[model samples]
Target: MEKTDFDTLIERSKNIRTAYHQLELQHHGSKWTIEEDTLAFLTDAGLVGRNTMSQQGRWPKTETDAELKHKLGECVWWLTVIADRMNIDIKDAVEHFLTKTENLLEK
Candidate 1:
């Protein structure tokens, strides 16, 4: 079966996260808990927000465009990882959210 881009993204994110977990086990003697993963996601999200503010001239101009873009991508990666950890299908969740929001907006 052909894989959609999102499917590829999900697989890749899971693979990379699993690899990182292994690395954590080696270096730290344990992998992160789901709560720690959530915290890490929030940390990345905060960086994304800071970069956005920098872009909008609302914060110190500390990050480059590339940095901002990378942070944005990292946020998506975190969301995918978090969803998978929670047994939620990220694609379906996003689809439902968009559909419901669109329907509401059209009303």
Candidate 2:
């Protein structure tokens, strides 16, 4: 497997979100409010959890790793979408979170 940088991953994720939005934008007719987006993001996150369970054979909804992997990717899409809509960078957010957390623990 090849490794990708965070920027590339974020960019690719944003591109996919754009493509998907193009398909459904007309139906939504406008962007959702932050609250709505947050709910949607959480829903996507729950789906990811379910996909993880499936991958682990814990009452799986999906029959294959491929399906689970696709769901996992969809979760990443939600993460990127939520961050984009909220005017945040996921890479920066995670890095800042980790640095803060580790520093706090060390002190």
Q: Which candidate leads the pack in TM-score?
A: 1
Candidate 1 segments exceeding 4 Å error: 1-4
lDDT string for model 2 (60-79, tens) is 37575776677677777777
Candidate 1 global TM-score: 0.91
User: Model-by-model lDDT, in order?
Assistant: 0.92, 0.76
In candidate 2, position 11 carries an lDDT of 86
Q: Write the per-residue lDDT of candidate 1 for residues 4-105, one digit (tens) a residue.
A: 599899999999999999999999999998999999999988988888888889997865688989889888999999999999999999999999999999
Clashing pairs in 2: none
Task: Write down the RMSD of all candidates, one decimal each.
Answer: 3.1, 2.7
Count clashing residue pairs per candidate. Answer: 0, 0
Pairs that collide, model 1: none
Q: What is the Cα-based lDDT of residue 39 in candidate 2? A: 82
